[model samples]
Target: MIYTLERTQFFTCGLDEAWAFFTNPNNLATITPDTLNFKVLDTFDTPEIYEGMIINYHVTPLLGIRLSWQTRITEVVPRASFIDNQEKGPYTLWQHTHEFFAEDGGVRVKDTVRYAMPFGVLGTLVHKLIVKNKLREIFDYRQQTLEKILNYPAHD
Candidate 1:
């Protein structure tokens, strides 16, 4: 079954700072959970993210076994938003969009990810038993780490 996950966080930083930091591919590993063993397999010549940019990486998302994943930047809008789709990955489909907006006293950041697992029915079962929770764990870690890094004020 296809699934979607959306997360938003308000950062007490300027839009430019948020955009620059998020667009830098290297920062991904920093925000990702250590258990995943996420590592970029390709080097980026420049920090700037642009359309058609491809990123390759490997991660041990389960069973401590690593698998390579590749994603391409499908669209980019300067300091506003960008979308990336899986070129080769574990999922049958994956598309993630990152958006940034200038907001009162800071920047609001959002991520929308739509993805589907492989193996048809088995994939759906696995997603129900594992993938669903793993994705939440990963994103939860990211949100906490970003909050610390970006200094978002505490919410009531």
Candidate 2:
């Protein structure tokens, strides 16, 4: 039940700006929908998020039922790329890689996530029925939010 979700976004901002936005936890809240109630479980300073850093998140993927998520950052190359793996969550194993590259006078941000649901057969069924679509919705919202944020002036 391994699955990979690949997405790419081109931003008008340079590499430094793109890196800053992606690394800053505050930006996550802005992009995430209020419905998910996405919040940082780790202290801002404690999860200084370098390679091998572990971070936790709590969110309700469905109506009123909350899920606790744990992920470890396995790789980091400053502005170039980073990879995160889910240690505990709804997934059996989830590995996500975020890559940044200069492109078309701006920057290209690419995300590749390989994952498997929790239950042997039931989880796979749930993923195909609901979880997969929810994930896509979350990313779609994020993409639009990022486009708006990156297009605006930084000081604004």
Candidate 3:
């Protein structure tokens, strides 16, 4: 079964600034939870994100067992949206779309992730028991971290 998660965050910055901050690979670690030990391993040919870019990372999501993940940038619309698909990762299928819109002198960022686990029924069980909540927590951490880094007031 495929599971979907969506989150939206409003930043006190314009679309261009928010787009630049989010697309820069170096800023990922700052937004991600430190417990994940997320590290990007690739040296990009260009600092600017573009279609067909492949990003590699090592992350420890659970049980202190590190995993290597590779994702390809499938779509890019500057200051608008981007989509990333998992090329190699724990999930059998992982596709995440990030969108930006101008809102109240800032930008409203929306993230939608669609993913499926490897196992069949067991994966569904895991999703209910653990994966779902874990994903929410991760995104929650990201929202707080981003707000702090961007100097935006936190929301409830």
lDDT tens per residue, model 3, 8-101:
9888877888888889877778888889999999887676778998999999999999999999999999889999999999999999999999
Candidate 2 lDDT by residue in tens digits, 33-104: 889988768776642358877778888879888989888888889889988888888878889888999986
Better of 2 and 3 by TM-score: 3
TM per candidate comes to 0.96, 0.90, 0.94
What's the residue-level lDDT of 127 in candidate 3?
Answer: 90
Error of 1 at 97 (Å): 0.3
**Over all chains combined, what TM-score does candidate 1 have?**
0.96
lDDT score, candidate 3, position 18: 87
List the global CA lDDT of all models: 0.94, 0.83, 0.89
The C-alpha stretches of model 1 lying farther than 4 A from their native spots are 152-156
Comparing 2 and 3 on lDDT, the stronger one: 3
TM-score-based ranking: 1, 3, 2
Clashing pairs in 2: none
Q: How close is candidate 2 to the true structure, as a TM-score?
A: 0.90
Best by lDDT: 1
